[model samples]
Target: MKIAMWSGPRNLSTAMMYAFGNRADFAAWDEPFYAAYLKRTGIDHPMRDEIIAQHDADSVSVSAQIAGPVPDGKEHWYMKHMGIHMEDTPLDWAEDCVNVHLIRHPARVIASYAAKRENPSFWDIGFQQQLEIFERFPGPVIDSADIRRDPEGMLRKLCIAIGLEFDPAMLSWQAGPRDFDGVWAAHWYGSVHKSTGFAGAEGALPELQDEAAKLVAQAMPFYAKLAESKLA
Candidate 1:
C-alpha cells in the first residue's frame, strides 16, 4: 500500500511516521518534496539555512533520494508530508495512493511555529491552502489530534478508508528510526528519533503572545469548520 500522510509542522507528524514505520513489513519516506521545492524555487524555508548549514545538503534532493526506490521488503509504504509542502508539487504524484490529510488547531500550531527561532509560519496562508485542497480531494481525510487520541480505532478507520483491513501492528511501534524515516530524522526530527511510542501527551503549547493568540483565533474558525466537515 502506498499511503501518504499530509500534515503541518510541529503537529506530531514525525511521531506519527515513527508509529507506522514500526511495522516490519512497511517502508516509509519523510518529506521528500522539501529539497526539490527549495532547489527549484530558490526560496528558503524557515530552517532551510540552518539545516543546510549543518547537513550541507538540500532538503529537496535528500527527500527525492529517500523516496526514490522502495526496497524489496514491506507490503505497506507510508509517506509523511507537510501539507504546506504541497503548494508547489504535482498532485498526480499522489495519484493511486491514499491521501490522509492531517490537521491541528491553529492556536497550537501558531504557538509551535513561533517557538522555533526561524520561519514564522505563514499559518493563515498554509491553512487556507490546505483547506481548499482537502475540499478538492476525493479520498479519505483525518485530523492528527484525533488520531493521537484513538490510535487503534483511528487506524482501523484509516485502513477501511483505503480498502484494507486493520492490522494489529499499526497501534504501536518499536523505538528508534526506520530506514524510511532516515531523511527526515537526519534533517527535521531529533526528539522523535528517540521516542519509543506515541508521545501521547496533549496540552497547551507555550503561552502565546496576545498578538499571536488573536491571529490564531482569527484562523481557528476556518480550521474548525474544515475539520468538522471532513472528520464528520
Candidate 2:
C-alpha cells in the first residue's frame, strides 16, 4: 500500500510521518517535492539553498521515484507532501495511493507559521492549493486538531478507512530525527523531533492580528471546505 498525505507546512505533517515511519511495515518519506519546489519557485525559505543543493531538484525524476516503488521492500510507503510544492509536475502518481488531506485551523496554522517565518503570503500556508488537490484526488481528510484530541481513535479509524490493519506503533515513537529527514529539518522539525508522542490536546485557537489575521481570514474558507470532510 502507498499512502500519499497532502498537507501544508506548520501542520502535524512531520509528526504524522514519524508515526507512520515507526510502524515496522511502513517506510515514510518527508516532502518529496520540496527541493523541486524551492528550485522552481526560488522562494527564499529558511534553508532554500541547502535544501536545493542536498535534495534532488529534478521534478520529473522525483515524480517518477515516488510512483515507482515502496523503498526498502516495506509493505507500505507513506509520503508526506506539501500541496504548494506541486506545480506543473504530473499528479498521476496520486492515482495509485490512498490520498489524504491533513488540515489544521488557519488561526492555529498562521500563528505557528508566523513564529518561524514572518509575513507569509496566502499561498505559503497552502489552503487553496490543497483544496485544488483534494478536488482532483478526493479521499479521506483528517484534521490535526482532531488527531491531537484522540490519536488512537482517529488513527484506528484512518487505518480502517484505508483497509489497513491498525498498528499500535502509530500512537508513539522514539524522539529524534530519523535518517530520512529532509535537509531542511534543522529549521523546521525541532519540536516534532523532540516529541515521543502526540502532544496533549491543543489549547484555544490563537488570536491573530494584522497580516496574520488577514492571512487566516483568507485561508479560513479553504480550510473549512477541507475540514468539512475530515474524519470525525
- Choose the strongest candidate by TM-score: 2
Error of 1 at 186 (Å): 4.9
RMSD versus native structure for model 2: 0.7
Worst 10 residues of 2 by lDDT: 207-216
TM-score of each: 0.79, 0.98
- Overall local distance difference test of candidate 1: 0.65
- Which candidate comes out best when scored by lDDT? 2
Candidate 1 residue lDDT tens string, 26-65: 7777776665555556675655654344442454455454
How far out, in Å, is residue 158 in model 1?
Answer: 1.7
Off by over 4 Å in 2: none
Ten-residue stretch with the least lDDT total in model 1: 51-60
